[model samples]
Target: MDPYAWSWNPEGLVVLLLAAGYVAALRRYPTPWWRPACFGVAMVLLLAVSVSPLHMLAMQYLLTVHLFQNVVLAEWAPLLVVLGLPPALAAAIARPSAMRLLTHPALALPVWLANYMIWHLPWVYDTALEHPSSLLHLEHALYFLTGLALWWSVVQDAPHELRAGTRAAVVFGAFVLVSPIGLVMALIPRAIYGFYVDAPKRLWGLSALQDQQLAGVLMALEQAVVFFAILAFWFARFFAEEDRREEIDRSPEAA
Candidate 1:
C-alpha cells in the first residue's frame, strides 16, 4: 500500500460519533465559543491522524510518524477534549464519586505515567504493531482514555479543580517522569522496536535506528514545550491567587 495514500478506519467513525454526541449535548447547555472551538480542533486532529496519509505512514513506513501519532493521541487531543467540556458538564461529570477518586492527582498522575511507559516498551510496542487488528486499537484507546484521565484534574473546573500550585507541580512532575523514556529512545545505541527495524526498505533513506532517534528527540522536545508552557500558565495563576489572598489579608476590613 502506498504510504502516502489516505486510509479510513473505524477510528474516523469514532471521532465523528464523539463529535455528534458532543454537539447533541451542547444543545442543553450554553457553551462558550472557545469550548466548541477546542473540541472541533481536537476532533479534527483525531480524524486527521486516523484517516489522512499520515496514518498510513505511521502504520507502515516510519516510527517517527507513529510516535507523532501517539503524541497527538495521548497529549494534544486529550488536553483539548478536556478543555472543551463546558464547566457545567465538567462539574456534573466530576460529581461522580468514582471520577473524583480516579482524577485525584495522587492516582491520575501515576496512572498516566505508567500508561505512557508501558505502551512504549519494545515488546509491547512491536506486538501492537504486529497485531494491529486487536492490540493496536486497544493501545490507541488506552492512550486516549488515560490521557483524558491524566488531564481531567488539570483542565476541568470540576468536583475538585486542582489549586494552581498543585496543578503546576503535577504538570512539572509529569514532564520529569516521562522525560526518561524519550531520552532512552534517543540515546540508545540501537532501535529497540524490532517491527520498525524489520520494516521494508525505510523511506527517506533513513535506517531504523536513525528514525527511532529522531522520533525520540521529537517526542522529548514536544513534551518539554507543552509541559513547560502549561507549567508557566499555572505558575502565573498561582502567583495571581497568592496576590489576591495577600491583598485581602492586608485590607482594612480584615484589620
Candidate 2:
C-alpha cells in the first residue's frame, strides 16, 4: 500500500526503451504523430499497470486489481499498440515468414486460449505468485504477447481486407470461450487464490470471496465491451462493403 515504493523492473525498462527508440525512428520514417503517441501512451499504461503502485496492489492485496491489469495489458495495450503502427511498419512486420505463420488465427487462437487457462490453474497460479522473479514476469509476458498475436490477426489487417465474417467469428468465439472463466470465478462462493485471502488487503472491508467475485464480474464485463465493440465495427464495415459492391454492380457502366 506504500504507493511511494514503485517497482522498476527490467520489463518496464525494456518497454520504455523500445518506445523511445520507436519515437526516434519516426523522425526518419516520417510517420504520423498519433502513431507514436498511441505507442507512447500504451507504454505509459504498461508501466502504470505493471510497475506502479497498481503492481503492488495486485501482487499483494487484491485479485481484482490483478485481473484488471491482465485485461489492460493483454487486451487494451496490445490492441492500441497494433493500431499505432504505421501501415508500412505493420506490413513489414507481417511480411516475415514466421510472423505470418504465428499471426494466423489457426495458430494464434488456441495458443492464446491455452496461455490464459494454464495460468489460472491452481498450482500454476500459486507457483507464479511464489516466484515473483521469473515466473510472474513470464506469466505477464505471455498474457501480453499472446494477446498481441491474437489482436494482430484482427487489427493489423483492416476489416475490409480480411474476411469480415471470419474476423467476427473469431472475436465472438473468444468472447464465448473466455466468459465462462469469469462466470465461474464470480459465482463460486469461496476464494480461489491463497495469497489474496489474508494478504494485507481490506480495501472496502471486502472479504477474499467478494474481491475474487468482483474480479470475475469485471472480467466478464470487460470482455463484453472489448469483443462486442470489435464485432460491431466489423459488421458495420462488412455491410458497408457489401452495399458498395452492390452499387458498383448496378452502375450504368456494368450494363
Candidate 3:
C-alpha cells in the first residue's frame, strides 16, 4: 500500500488550509504577543504531526504514531485553537446573520453534540483509517469545527452569551458525557481497527494495548484540562460580577 498514494493528499491539503487559516487569523486579530506566538508554536507542532512527512513515516510503522495522530487531531490541536480564540476570523465570518444562526438555541447545541457522537463511533473511526485520505479529511474538519463550536460557547469573549455558571456547567457536562467514549476505547479488548493492528510499533516501546491506553490518557487529560480551565474562569467571572453588584448596591444613589 502506497502510504502517500493520494491517500494522504486530502490530509495534506487540510494541513495547508489550517496553517493558512492560522496566519489569516493572526493578521486579523492582532493578538497579544504571547497568545499568538504560543498558538503559532502549537499549530506548527500539530501540523507537523498530522500532515508532515514525519507523520507519514511514523504511520507506516508504529501504533504509537497512530495514537499520536489521534491525540494531535482530537485533543492538542483543538485545545490550542480554542485558546487562540481566533476572534478576528470568527468575528469576520460571523456576520450578524451567521451569529444569529450559530446562537440559535435550537440549532447550536444539538449539532455540536451530534457531531461529537458521529465521529467517535468505532465504525466511523475505522472507515477513516481504511480510506486514509478523504474520510480522514472529513473527520478532521468535523472534529475541528465541533471543537470550535464547543469552545466558542464556553470560552469566547462574546456578548450576550450564556452566563459564567452556565458555561461552566456546559463544559463540565460535555466532559461527563464524553467519558463513556473514552472508557469504551480503553476497555475494548481486541484491536477495534485493523489499521493499528497492522501498523509497525515504535517510540516508547508501546504495544497496541499500551498505545490505546495512552490514547485514553490523552483524551482524559484533555477533558480534565478543558473542564477545569472553564470552571476556573467561570468562578472568577461569577465572583467579579457579584463584587460589582455589591459595589453598585452600596453607591450613594442607592443609599
Q: Which parts of model 1 are misplaced by more than 4 Å?
A: 252-255
Query: Residue 55's C-alpha lDDT in candidate 3?
Result: 66
Query: If both were scored by TM-score, which would come out higher, candidate 2 or candidate 3?
Result: 2
Using lDDT as the measure, name the better of candidate 1 and candidate 3. 1
- Compose the digit string of candidate 1's lDDT tens values, residues 1-255: 687899888899999999998998899877989999999999999988899998988988899999999988999999999999998988887888999888888899899889989999999999999987799889999889888888897878686867899989989999999999888989999989999888876898889999999999999999999999999999999999999998988897766
lDDT score, candidate 2: 0.82
Model 2's number of clashes is 0
Alpha carbon deviation, residue 56, candidate 3 (Å): 3.2
Worst 10 residues of 2 by lDDT: 158-167
Error of 3 at 82 (Å): 4.4
In candidate 3, stretches whose alpha carbon ends up further than 4 angstroms from where it belongs are 1-10, 17-29, 57-68, 85-89, 103-110, 200-205, 252-254
* Candidate 3 per-residue lDDT over residues 1-255, each given as its tens digit: 444422345565666776687777676577766666656666776677666655674456444455556556655566576566556565655557766566433455566667767766767766776775587668767766666566666666553366777776776677787666656667777656566656754445767676666676666666677667767888888888889888988897776
TM-score of each: 0.97, 0.92, 0.77
Per-prediction RMSD in angstroms? Answer: 1.2, 2.2, 3.9
> Residue 128's C-alpha lDDT in candidate 2?
90
The CA lDDT at 228 in model 1 is 98
Using lDDT as the measure, name the better of candidate 2 and candidate 3: 2
Worst 10 residues of 1 by lDDT: 153-162
lDDT of 1: 0.90
